[model samples]
Target: MMNSRDFHRSPSFTERLSGLSTAFKMFPFIQTGQRILQPFLEKFGFSVQEVTDSVKLFLTNGHPALTFPFLRPPNNILIGCANLLGSKSAPLQFSPQISQFLNESVGKDVVYVSFGPYVKMSGVSWYSQLVEILTELDLRVIVKVDKEFEKEFPKSVLPLNWAPQKDLLRSGKIKLFISHCGNNGKMETIYYNVPVLCIPQFADQPVNAELVKVKGFGESLMKEDISVRAKEVIAAMIANHGTYHRNMKRASDIVENEPGNARENLLYYVEQVAEMGNVDYLVNKVARQQSTVEMYNLDIVVPVVVIVIVVVGFILYVLLKFCVYFSRKVGMAGFRKLKNE
Candidate 1:
């Protein structure tokens, strides 16, 4: 059901921010110290007031924004809801499929390559470079390319139009993931405890890639350097597999320990938003808080008062000059009359 048209009709920045603010209002605990920026929505001429109104409507109407499956409640407030499949209780059915593929391989050295659902390799020049790099590497590759590019790849590169990615990752054969850094791909990589080589193309992919680096899960490569970087990173990942595995296991454990199921988390926030009705209370609370105190705060207030005083003094000076000129004219007229008499 998701198509190019649906993708192109993506929500504006204002809409996204408003939705996030509403989510935050619904669950204030989700707000980390980090500021959430919604400038893109504002750039399109959406005022903060208008965005707030819309968010109010969405919350009151019981139409919380669609979220991902893996997201749990307080986590949802912070991370927003993930797709349904991403839920914590979601079955680990995909892992076995990947395991079967790995069992067929002679060694436990395999690379998983996927550009994600939204991205395709049919016309992209990088596809050929990726193929060339994988051919040179000492590992088997399981690639998920567009159906159109199936014939272009070699036999060693196990090409599928659409592969069971989650299953494949859990198969234990996959040594590293050459990914486009999609959320689903990132989560799957984390869930299966697989190391990644992120090649982010657009949207929140760069953010996800940064997260990967921060988490010590893997390296990020520029799309332009797919050929050279892929080979190098792949070699490094293979060489440091033990470290990668350790980091991945740690991340998985952290995710697993989080409280509540993804659905329970999502519904809890949604119910909270319904109860709160609007973001007015949250916004007011934030506005009233003093971020920091400054000694020169009073000095800033004094300048406006000084400017007003100067403007009023100038006006009075002009009025007095006009009165003097009129009085002098009248006196001169009287003196003229006396001389005539």
Candidate 2:
């Protein structure tokens, strides 16, 4: 679906995923994007005969998804967000608690912002500036920082270096989740039906952010114009909860309503792997290779081209010889007639 055209709306006019074979690896594969990764990682000349594409497998076992081409649907997958069922890496251990900041929550009043482990804040000043901007817009924000972060803040802002992310998002007060849009973060934000405000830092984050934007549940922005864009996006997400929440609910419903849900699918494959290092029957043994001729069709096309060129050249050479021979024959006959006269 990705490497084709007219179906997906590209963010930039010049950017098209259809031409980029590895681009799909960044799209949400309805779970954690492990499925997308296998194809991409394999494109690097590494032969990974993977098994599944859903995020459930990765989160549950840190497993790479299997490469099953036929079974996957052509359209975007519809696994519900909540099927993850708020499974946090740990519990709600740190907080002033998200609940404490909820009196004005219209789902937009409070925002949660954390750049995951990979993205470092520019410095303490940048962190301070971010907190100041949100509070200036009359918003309640909790920023996850380091244990040593000691920025002074107004009572409305809670700047904790750490907090229970799943707990905060589950709190009804959390209207928006501002993050780097990592796959795990995407799963958590969407599963809880919390809308997103993404500022992607690196790797697949940009692709993940684009996925969120396309889903109609959230918005993505460049790191530039931080103060203005943050205010603009936060206001929009809060004010238009009707639209965003509806889309979020629809996506979650699909996941939650699955007959046994994603967990069963993940377990099914995992158990099979345990019984046999891999289920030989399930893995596609056919390599997608083309014989030198089958791949480029050089055997057929090359010979045909060569034959045409030879035939054309031969005809031209004969035509030139005939013109030369006929002209000489006429000249010799004319000379003989003149001598006789």
Candidate 3:
């Protein structure tokens, strides 16, 4: 359920450094939380970190394009296939109003906007501004908001508390998605090959939003800047729609045809453990047995680092000694020659 990058082993050096710095900065808050929870967790016989460490397997629901494309996870970890590729027998039924709106907007590009259920924009100052911008766009617009806010927008726009998001994205009429960039929404858009205009609110949404841009399937804007930049960003994405389409289409193809099937992988592992009656072979014994120091290779790292420093120090000492000896000898010889002259 975590972002794949959190578990990814081989990040670029700069990214690794940045992660290390973040860990350091957050260490104090982490320690404080641990201290507050230590007494309560002692009753359960393990700490917070131990919960994840004790797990025998981690099943992630995403394609390798969003996970580790070039590398495989350890035996204990399984990258499950994208959920969109799974069962879709019961498709979401759209309301009559929404259905009619889609029908009338035929032959025109549609933009689907939803911030997800968790985020409420009713109190935000920019909500009205966003509605105004949506009203002005010539493209057909479908926005998901509370029913109370529905009256704020013109009749041309359709505002519902909920939208058949997956169905609409799959409808092919939706050329762009305006989203808060939640993980599930991002994956759905990717599955549907629709470009996104991300205005992330918080948490993993920002990370997902950045990846949208990095993957070249979309662009991102800060939530605060949306009131000012939303119109321009939307127009630009629509103008360059082809490039985004191609990028997302490639991703969709990879997820559908990726070498290891996500569902199959999960089922196989479960069946294996059930038949064997234990995960002995699957578990990394050394990893589980090791303390934090050894787990990070800090035990080995510290000594190796000390050895390197000592070796370099010894080399510098010898070089200095030789230089001093040579200089003295040359100076003495010159003095003797001068005395003779």
Name the best candidate (by lDDT). Answer: 3
lDDT of 3 by residue, 96-213 (tens): 9988998898888788889897667676667667767766778778888865563566656888888888888887789899898987888888777899998877556766787788
Badly placed stretches (over 4 Å) of model 2 are 1-83, 86-108, 122-127, 290-341
TM-score, structure 2 vs. true: 0.61
Per-candidate TM vs. native?
Answer: 0.59, 0.61, 0.69
Name the lDDT value of residue 323 in candidate 1: 96
> Taking the tens digit of each residue's C-alpha lDDT, what string does model 2 give over 64-181?
1111121232222223232454353335533345455554454447878898754556464555766777888888787777655655677777766567787787655676788888
Model 2, position 181, has a per-residue lDDT of 86
C-alpha lDDT values of all predictions:
0.61, 0.61, 0.72
Cα distance off (Å), candidate 2, residue 171: 1.8
Worst 10 residues of 3 by lDDT: 1-10
Residues forming the 10-long window of minimal summed lDDT in candidate 1: 59-68
Across 204-242, the per-residue lDDT of candidate 1 in tens digits comes to 677667667766888888888776567777788889988
